[model samples]
Target: MAAAGVSLGATVLCLLAWAGLAAADRVYIHPFHLLVYSKSSCEQLEKSSAETPKALTFTPVPIQAKTSPVDEEALREQLALATEKLQEDDRMRAAKVGMMLNFLGFHMYRMLSESCSTASGTVLSPTTLFGTLASLYLGALDPTASRLQAFLGVPGEDQGCTSRLDGHKVLSALHTIQGLLVAQGGAGGQSTLLLSTVLGLFTAPGLRLKQPFVRGLAPFAPVTLPRSLDLSTDPDLAAEKINRFMQAVTGWKMDRPVSGVSPDSTLLFNTYVHFQGKLKGFSLLPGLQDFWVDNATSVSVPMISGTGTFQHWSDAQNNLSLTRVPLSKNACLLLVQPHGASDLQQVEALTFQHNFLTWLKNLSPRAIRLTMPQLTLRASYDLQDLLAQAKLPTLLGAEANLGKISEDNLRVGKVLNSILLELKADEGEQPTESAPQPDGPLEVTLSRPFLFAIYEQDSTALHFLGRVANPLSTV
Candidate 1:
């Protein structure tokens, strides 16, 4: 009887061991990885059961929630202690700021790399995505802490030494993380939890106290202008005016001529202007058109054209009207010649009013010190010699550069111009007649800070630039 009992016991033990091994094989440690593993394991189990007569009991292991217990009272005391310590230890504050910035940079790269796909449609690798998200998470979490260091006005080495860890920064960071997850297509309860936690952290006054005073002050600050402008508009008159301004400011000419027949002696041109002063404000006024031209048939209608001190001759084409202005050395004047011979005077008057109003709208009454550090103008480029150099993306195919331009490119141009104007306005300066010579590419550099604003004339919607200096500080 004893021998028989031992045999049975051994058989039972063996079965238990086998079951344990199977469970180990099927187990997934990480919750995220479980979705992929669970399906495969269940399929395998079903196949095995079909082949074998034995019953295979499969029980899924409960996912262990990984969380640290938080005693609210204890955390408050610890945080208070930390704040006191920070007041004395400059090294600690500096270390924290460095950690936060490193984290931020990582996430910024991650989000941008993941969200933006190349024109060819290649997605970012998982490893890359992970790294990017991690970086952004860290950065968003500590902006206030970092900004506080900036505010204390501490000099190097000792700077940020006494900085406080802003709870607000943590909340902001969490919010940003939730946004990034949504952007990456994550949905469901986990995302909701993250958002809720962030909101709760922000609502706590003690946590809010941890944020920098400057960060707190952000909400009460006045709206500023943008660093760029988008002046590209349809209706030949608007485009023409913008082009003339660019020519007058930059001393450059359009690579191609405007489409359609010029009115008797009238010429069509477009130019991108550069100004040194900061932007203030901008407004647009709608008025009745003096006359209408068949825009659908017009090929390249000149926006702005005039003879300047640095004149360059453009090769003539029958279907196009061309104008070249040189703005390199001296202040240049540009005369915009409108199409339609019968209403030539009306066109001229409209063009002049449009230019004047645009200029006036951009100059705001509120004064703020603003400067533009850089500016760039992008347009369709025509390669005079294809064999001379490998064609880059900017070069339009054999199709005429200006003639083949699409609505998207025009929209992009307008956005860019509007942003520029806004940047100038934010700096509390008005655009003046300072046509800085282009040293390298078609770009300009401002001596002071600036603001940016963008407007879509078609939709009449204003798009503000989200930046550290702008109204939307958290983004």
Candidate 2:
């Protein structure tokens, strides 16, 4: 219930901002203004009496490594205090941060989907990516800091320290969002939703890391494990080591070893996220169904179907239809599919429009029979590559100052953000074999390439955005 109220006002504010403000409130407030902080204020907050965040060390563990013991009560107390600081203006600011991350992650999703359209579809965790950038911002200095700030959608950066933003506030807001999701999801038990994240910092041997910088990452992930590895000499071995370490610690098995690590790089920031959603009224169909990857390509895959009243919209003008299926009381799934002969590319282009989020707001409830694949979508990408694609090659390049993270002339390696999404029928629900009535629900089947998004109903936050071109591919 607490999670439901976290930034609940933000959803209303966003709607008012976009849907046109009332006559009494004609002064339009830009969302970014909510997050702006004066330099003096940021400095004062940092010097406050809050306990210093614990510094994590890069100590290597064995192949079958076990997670270090954590004092659950102590960690909870610390998090509760940190979150308590975010109850007032911090809530709206966190909501704005979530919005900013959604925009950035949307663009990244587009770029990735384009590059991998033929081979496989793509998935991105906006929250995880935001945490990665926020982590980097923790160590950035001068122009690098300014650039990262701009990338984060904070305005008025050109002005001076008076307009500087507090990295702690942003990271704290991010932590609040993560906490809200876990709390809301767990309220329904494992039968509804289960979400987890792990932050892995793979550093070069003997690279001295700053205490404050390492300590600052505490709130952004549940498990922040920094380890030393011989990444440069044998990249394959390092990848295998990371996979083994994660499996040993979290019991999460990766489909393949991570690739694309630069041998010259020093620190690799890796975040792994897992999310599973079980539909209430859905059940697996008897056998495989024909899924149209494109107009010409098709494959047989497992399908699930259910009949229920769902929030839906058909944008005939844009040649696409939107469907919102409930995953839990706090989260839902948005499915967008192009009509007629239109393809996934056409649907992707629609995201660039200013009124994209409005589509979600405009959905109307409709009784329909929805049939879609039983998805186990997996995606991996290096943040460095995404930066290059955005034409910001030097944001983390050699010239950047990262003194807060390390003194060595460090080459930032692959900032990996791996995501896995699983959606299946709730085992408690039984499949119905009754014949359709004369006035049956409208049938809407996803047999072609389409786009999907996981959204938080309470905060109106976009957690994950992705496209599914083929049901069989899990890249």
Candidate 3:
């Protein structure tokens, strides 16, 4: 995929050089003294090599975007040239996003997952997190965009005037899936699925965000807010004020808000996802069900069980089992739990895996009486911490040129992602939860910790991911 990006960038660079539209970035070609041809011959060869291409293509090339005060025209032309490539790249965008998000998800989740190792579950929305960074990429220049493009699994664009695989395209692709989930939020049953998200941009009172950057975030339904913060004078106080703002917006769904706002920071980014899943014909166990909170301890919690034909598989070598149940027209609730003596941690090490879905493609439906805990969770993270954990601490570093984000020198404040997930029974369909159990189906119970991910059926995007240890705790 990166090869495609490099090729596209190189192609555009080659075209621009041929037309004399690019001057800032150059490839110096020189014929030297000894191994090279004589000076006279070298001069003639260079002239012909440079002029031959322009001669072959009679069409006069227009000025590129970066060379002028207005960049829209250049970007549009670039997009036009890459239409075929963009279409092909768009087809694989979801898979690309999934692989990249999960890869980042695994590393990011490792730290917080372990922090909640002995507690309840931890939840996260890969799309929400990825979108925020992608938005920043919209405003970023060169090196910063270059670093983030790899993290985002997006290709590089022409510089001075850069590439056309704009951050907006990636964010829009994700928003399209989100739109599908919201539209397909099926009617009441034991499991009804609904998903929605919002982005909050809090900036220092006087800083101005770039038009393109602001426009790029419109699809994500961002709420713009300018707040007065003496960031440089008192960063800690500024952090607290921003934290309060987020708490009010999220209704305190997240704890601690986000800490460590740089003193020079002019803005902060936050996004939240709300998801509710209720399954039909799945009812609570006769009584409180016992759960193994850890290897050495156990607690009783409300549990639900249902008998049905569902896709099921296992990695016996890893003592893990996966059960996929449909939630809505465009989504499914995927459950992964440890079997026998295997711990949830081992299963955590496996969820959001690259080939896991490839393996799931071959899942054979089977009859099983599956029992899972009543789930209610809220998981939160500081995005900067995730970058640091991924060993790319320089992403939002000082050298980053985020001109599109704001005109002022901005310091990024709390980059937070908070996700809320609740599994419940539909109020109107309460009685349907009591359908007769199958006489001889296999009994599979999640009376212990387990890992889970929600998939958007159409796009096959990993919407939300987490591990549940205790049904009650909000991570």
Candidate 4:
């Protein structure tokens, strides 16, 4: 009986080992052969998927307001040529902001998604997060700076010097993208985008800030310093003071965001972003659109409609469809929607990769009639907590040397980032005659939970990343 039991145990162990190998075989890569991936396995999974690649059948239409210039005979060719020339501050347009956002948005999604899972709507400023990190990069020293460079995706200035990470260059690139959006009527035309960036460093008494760090922020952030308060006691008072300061800075238009303060801390880093945008040729649909909350539930909210020739893409593997509508002269609103039959969670894995934005650039130009809810989003996040969630708390922890920010032994405390985005169409606005008549137009509606991002066309970097699962929910 003991011999029989031993044999049975050995058989069970063998079976478990076989199962483990089988599971790993599906996704595992040999450490030494990292470049090699199983094409057959990937193909098998794609072929087995229920969703089919959507056909890009929508015919292209002329895209221009009545007051705007006439569409050229070679309009599509002209657009393709123009788009090819698009470059922002020496970085490729495809990865400029997409790379940074993919890094930061994942953390924000992980940290905020659960809280928003209950309410069903969440917004994050990838640009603000990027700027904050750039500021941190400016203040960090040695190993901390090296770690930050990796986090910010700064590929060093070629071979000779891998020692010092250039924070100014990274910040300037981000600012250049913003500059393209904020410029009034460049060769691209008048933009309907209004973006306000404010970066603040609130330091306790006595410690003097560095001139280099102060000047470094000028290109990236309009407001870098000039406020202080006792962070020692009374969390409520600190909140009030911060709120009041923010109000004065923003003309009292934003709501107060809650934050925690440390008694022993001497410094607080804050970044605020406010965005207001309007689609030039889009019109508001008078009725509230039905946005599906789940398989059996839905909510009603105001929706806007637009029609024009736009770039569109669909993926069968991820169960997602995407399109780009120019939000301003230089910024485009890239919208993604999962099939009504599928949940938002179905396409979520795509966000973790750079492929999400890459797919947008490869879309075929098609005529589309889109209906989406007007956007009003206000969110605040603690950068320190986000960094901790990223598993690198020590990079900006109490032990961090932020000498570039100030000469004293400053302990970096709470880092707060606040964002306000208001996206809407003009009341009683009407679409131009050139707008595609809905008869056979590719009708795309955000009547279900969908993801949206506003990216600079010149740089292709996302400024705002958000989703509207329940539009009526309080932000």
RMSD of each: 28.8, 6.9, 13.2, 16.7
- Can you list the residue pairs that collide in candidate 4? 97-461
**What would the TM-score be for candidate 2 when compared with the true structure?**
0.82
Per lDDT, the best of the predicted structures is 2
Worst 10 residues of 1 by lDDT: 193-202
Task: Tell me the deviation in Å of residue 214 in model 4.
Answer: 1.5
TM-score of each: 0.17, 0.82, 0.72, 0.73
Tens digits of per-residue lDDT, candidate 3, 352-444, equal 544456667757677777788887787778877767655656678666777666657767766778777778654334222223545666677
Model 4 lDDT, full chain set: 0.62
Error of 1 at 241 (Å): 43
Candidate 4: give its CA RMSD in angstroms. 16.7
What does candidate 1's lDDT look like per residue over 185-218, in tens digits? 1122111101011000001011111123223321
Off by over 4 Å in 1: 1-95, 118-424, 427-475
Worst-scoring 10-residue span by lDDT in model 4:
58-67
TM-score winner, 2 or 4? 2
Clashes of each: 63, 0, 14, 1
- Can you tell me which runs of candidate 3 are displaced by over 4 Å? 1-103, 110-120, 157-164, 185-191, 222-226, 232-240, 250-252, 285-287, 427-439
